[model samples]
Target: MKQVEIISGGPELLDIVEPLWAKLNEYHKKRSTHFSHKFEQLTFEKRKQNLLKEACDVTINLIVDQTNNAYVGYCICTVNKEKQGEIDSLFIENEYRKYGLGAELINRSITWLENYQAQTIVIGVSEGNEHALDFYQKFGFYKRRYILERE
Candidate 1:
């Protein structure tokens, strides 16, 4: 974890973040008690397209480990036409998890969203990853609502 740096950019960073995003998708798949199949169908390109929708503003921040010149984590932030903000996706490499990278990622991203005047910011945590609830709580994100789908 030596020589760590955080870089920020727009949609062009999407391709750069794909591998890390894939790992995050797998994590969600394993932890999702009911939506594993939903994740199975989610590909990087598909997800990118979702983010590219015309109505929202997108920004990404990546944590790079200069020691090996590798990207260890990334956070994606978005704000829609309605000024609704979202910390849409966040992940830190398993090797990088215990070192506070995730917290830094969310903090910087949320600050960016706030600077953009985000009216409301939210993060959608998949079910079964409830272990992260406490982490999100530290950033002042609490469970205000949960939507269940009939399967």
Candidate 2:
């Protein structure tokens, strides 16, 4: 059995998540029915830049396998000055997904966001990724509305 730990930080740690983020992008690409092209275009650098530009406060929680010295999962939470919170991203390595890593990451992020006095919190799951709806609902994230985008 491997020991696990969670590390916390801000934008300074963004580089560490690139590989994990890329794996997430590939996951979406495979599951997507209509937006694989969008995922294909979403490079980690571009996504990182967007996060840097938009988020006023950021919390990145990384789940590490201490013995293996590996980052098995991560979640990014952001809060703006207006107290709007977002679970910007989350991913766990395929093998690690069965270990409840995703739920742990979300719980940590939600607690952090609440600590910041966030009035409204949100999460955006890609169109073809509705399979995660049940998982997210466990965290009190129910769909309020949907914004359909055109091709």
In order of appearance, the predictions have TM-scores of 0.96, 0.96
lDDT for each candidate structure:
0.90, 0.90
lDDT (10s digit) by residue, model 1, range 94-124: 8888888899989998899999999999999
**Model 2, global lDDT:** 0.90
Q: Mark the 10 consecutive residues where model 2 has the least summed lDDT.
A: 92-101
Q: For residues 102-129, could you state the per-residue lDDT of candidate 2 as single tens digits?
A: 8989999999999999999999999778
Q: List candidate 2 segments past 4 Å from native.
A: none
- Clash pairs of candidate 1? none
- Assess candidate 1 and give its TM-score to the true structure: 0.96
lDDT (Cα, 0-100) at 23 in candidate 1: 94
Candidate 1: lDDT of 128?
A: 80
